[model samples]
Target chain A: MRYERPTTLKAAAQMLAKEKGQAFILAGGTDLLVRLRTGFIEPDLIVDIKSINGSKTIQKTATGFKIGSAVSGAELGEHAALKKAWPGVVEAANLIGSKQVQGRCTMTGNLCNASPAADSVPALVAAAAKVVIVGPKGKRTVAAEEIPVGPGKTSLKKGEIIESIVLPKRPPKSGDAYLRFIPRTEMDIAVVGVGVSLTLDGKGVVTKARVALGAVAPTVRLVPAAAKALIGTKMDKAALDALAAACSAACSPIDDKRGTRDFRIKVAGVLARRAAVIARKRAGGK
Target chain B: MSGITVNAKINGDPVEFICEADETLLDVLRNRLGLTGAKEGCSTGDCGACSVTVDGRLTCSCLVLGAEIEGHNIGTIEGMAHGEELHPLQKKFIEHAALQCGVCTPGFLIAAKSLLDKNPDPTETEIRFGLAGNLCRCTGYDKIVRAVQDTAKEMRKTNSRKGA
Candidate 1:
């Protein structure tokens, strides 16, 4: 295997373009190294992005926060501004692996890995996050939902690498929550993951809602039907039940070692309902 | 394969080594520098036997490459003691009988050191969460937790005495 550490974005893009899909970008190596050791990925070249300047920063912009692709999960969890603006996103990023794994796992690696079980994907989808992609030609931004095409697949063309993730500024009285069902408490893959975000008007009614589910489909799924259940309601028990049912109906899970299909589907509904309730409480709902 | 030179401060010493492309931090630490305190139980991140402090963060040495350690500071279990005197946590572990088979002792020690460094007064739950990554099959963890609590008391006493 060949290793290249480029210090600049342009140099990294040139290297990526030259190697095309044969090159894999190494962020924290929490996932990539394990995959490489297990022969899951056989990239001819490895591009180390840690040396790339300005790729490990998290900054606030006029619109929202810009999370650099190489920002570690631990860093995301500890950022005070991110915790206040998008707590669910921080929670999802924190759930990626154990403390050791979080120390090295990057949000970009989690997203680009494109696993349906990736913890951060559902939260990013719920937050309406945008992915910034850079390549030899130039840079472009795409919706998080549009980035992943299937399991372990992405719409990124050859030589394209994710640069950052952008989350829009959250309005007041808006909150988000993410929860996942795993066999063990920590250091286990998600059987099902749910992210819920709601915006409440002054009268304590949900005006806007976003619900996303993970590990229940080919990719992280945004259930519009579930969100619709809370669009004009007060997030009452009946509304939460309706949203739960919609989320369960929208999922297409498969039986695997982590959990059975029936169990995953059931837990998906439960997590979605719980997340919605927590998010509602966060949004100042009674 | 191009030879990459990794320069870092390891255990309070400036260390430099030439490593191969696929060489992990564990490999460089064990084979090149002969710092065998960090054990390799499961090469994967599941087993925290290879835990090390990289720039004040607990990380699995097996998951990191040697080239990633440029300009970083690493602290292995070897850095815990000062000359012939053992660190307080190490002394407390012995007093509280925190080990039996001793295979997982180094990893546990490093992990416990990390916890105490971060939160000097960690509760039992906090300690459990802090050391959750490191696994110990022997002693059932009751004694280990007691040892950490005892170590915290001892450290606090030492600090108060110095202040006085």
Candidate 2:
């Protein structure tokens, strides 16, 4: 396979525009190389983005944090500001694969891969993250929830590559948590992943909430009904149960080698409830 | 395929090598430099048998391209020893009998080196988490943990002596 390591974003975009669909963007290459060797992808050219000088930065901006698409999971987990503002994002990044995999896996790559089992997607979606894409058409941003169209499919057009991920400023008295259920802890795909973010009023009632699920559908799903169930509620056991039920109802899982549809649906509810409890605690709820 | 020249410090030695565009860091370490310490058990990065320290970060060499290490410093198991004596972790691994088949020993040694470099005194649980990437199917990990703990003590003793 041919490889091109562009040192600048413009050069990389220009190369992608020139090669079009024949070139694949390489960041980390933890997932891409595996797919390539396994015959899952046969791109004629690989555009290496590691050489791009500015693609590995994590900076705090007016809009919160701009995480470069090429930032490794280890870097994300170790980022001081990221850990303080969005601890769930750090937790989710840390849960991907293993230490070796985390050393090379990128958050943008995880989202671009569009795997239902990707650990980072639920957290990003729950955080209402936005993705910056650069191509021959210039730069555009899209909501994280709208980025993936289906399993292993994205809305990104040809020649476009994810530039960075933009997270909104962390709201006061709000916290997020991401939890995934896998048969074995490390190096296994998620059976059911849940991410929940809740903002609480002084009265301990949830003012706003967001819930996202992964590995239980064709793509990571945002459960609006589940979020609505928690809004204005005091996050009691009954309310949490209702939210979990809503999350389970929202999931449309298929029976696969990893788990049965029934098991996934059941665990989706369990994980959703667990994540909500953690988020509630983080939000300083009683 | 394009040809790339990678210039980096490998095991405290400055080296330059020409690598194929598709070549991974693991390939260069093993095939070109003959540093076979980083074994390729699973090129997919799951096995962690090809773990190495790249610029003070523990990473799977198989997942990184050779060209990606332009000016980075890398440490393999070969770097864990001094002139006439082995590193504390290496000596402790032998004293603690942390290996059976020895296939996973190199990866374990490198991983232990990384963990100790980052945190000189890691708890058993921390050691387990730090070495979670490296898999050892032979030894049940009890001996490995013991080896690391014992090496930490040895290192502390050596440091204290130097301080004295």
Candidate 3:
């Protein structure tokens, strides 16, 4: 195997594009190294992206924030502006693993790992986040929800790397939160995860909302039905009930030792409702 | 496969080593450099027995590739003490009997030191969450938590005396 640390995205893309055997992009190596150790994958080439300039920065743009693909979860939490603007996203990213893992795990790595139960993806989806994909061809931006197609699968074309994730600036009276259910308190994968983001008008009625669920399908799901339930209401019990029902109806989870299918489906709604409540409070609601 | 030579700083000293492209930092530290302070408990990130600080960020050596540390600074358990005197956390751990098997002690010490560095006065709950990555099966963790608490208190007093 060969290890190449390219200082430019184009060079990295070209190396991956030209590789004949299996190749994996090394960001934090939190997931890749584990896969290598478990005999789960053997790649002929490893492209380390950390050397790329500005790959570890969190830049604030007039539009939103551009989180470099190599930025660790710990760094994200330390970015006060970014964390204050997108608490749900930062919290979700921080919840990926333990404090040690947070020092090495990147949101882009979590998204690209394409695990249906990835803790950060649901929050990114709810935030209506877009990823900057760079490749030999050029650059393009797509919704975060479009990246994961299935368990352990991504829609990124060969050699296309996610350079950064762009999160839109939050409007006034907007808040978001992510919640996940795990058997143990820490160092455990999510059994069911929910992320809720909403904006309220002057009257405190939800003007816009996005609801996302993870660990319930092959890919992280953006449930328009659940969001629709919250858009026109003040998130009262009736609105929250409708939101929960929609979330429950969206689940097609599988039965695993961590959680049964029914349990996950039931917990999905429960978590969604609870998350929306936290988001509402954060938005300065009563 | 040919070896990749990397230049890095470990335990406050510059070191150079050659390792395979796929070799983990844990293997590089233990096998190549003979800095076995970081152990391979799980060879996965789940267990923090291989905990170390890469560029002052607490990380699992098992999860990092050796090639990634070419220009980084690494802090292992071996760096926790002065020439003769033990670090406050180290002394406190012994005074409080924080270990039974001693395998997880290195990881616990590194993690505790990192925690105290970030937050000089962490609460009991904060200490527990900060050290959640390192698992101690022998000690029920009460003793370990107490040791960290005592170290924090002692360190605060010493610093306050200097300030005075």
Best candidate (score: lDDT): 3
User: After superposing candidate 2, which stretches have Cα over 4 Å from the reference?
Assistant: B160-164
lDDT of 2 by residue, A33-138 (tens): 7887667888878888877776899999887999998999999988998888898878998899877777778999999899998999999999999999888888
The CAPRI classification for model 1 reads as medium
Question: What does the lDDT come to for candidate 3?
Answer: 0.95
Candidate 1 per-residue lDDT over residues B12-128, each given as its tens digit: 799999998788899899999999988888778887889998998888899998888989999999998999999998998898889898777888888888888878899999888
DockQ-based CAPRI category assigned to the predicted complex of candidate 3 = high
Candidate 3: where are CA atoms >4 Å away? none
Could you give candidate 3's per-residue lDDT for residues B1-164 as a string of tens digits? 79999999998799999999989999999999888989999987988999999999999999999999999999999888998999999999999999898999999999999999999999999999999999989999999999999999999999999999
Best by TM-score: 3
Which 10-residue window of candidate 1 chain B scores lowest in summed lDDT?
Answer: B127-136
Ranking of candidates on lDDT, top first: 3, 1, 2
i-RMS of candidate 1: 1.1
lDDT of 2: 0.88
- Compare the candidates by DockQ and give the number of the best one: 3
Instruction: Report the error of model 3 at residue A60, Å.
Output: 0.2
- What is residue B69's positional error in candidate 3, in angstroms? 0.6
DockQ of candidate 1 (2 decimals)? 0.71
By TM-score, the better pick of 2 and 3 is 3
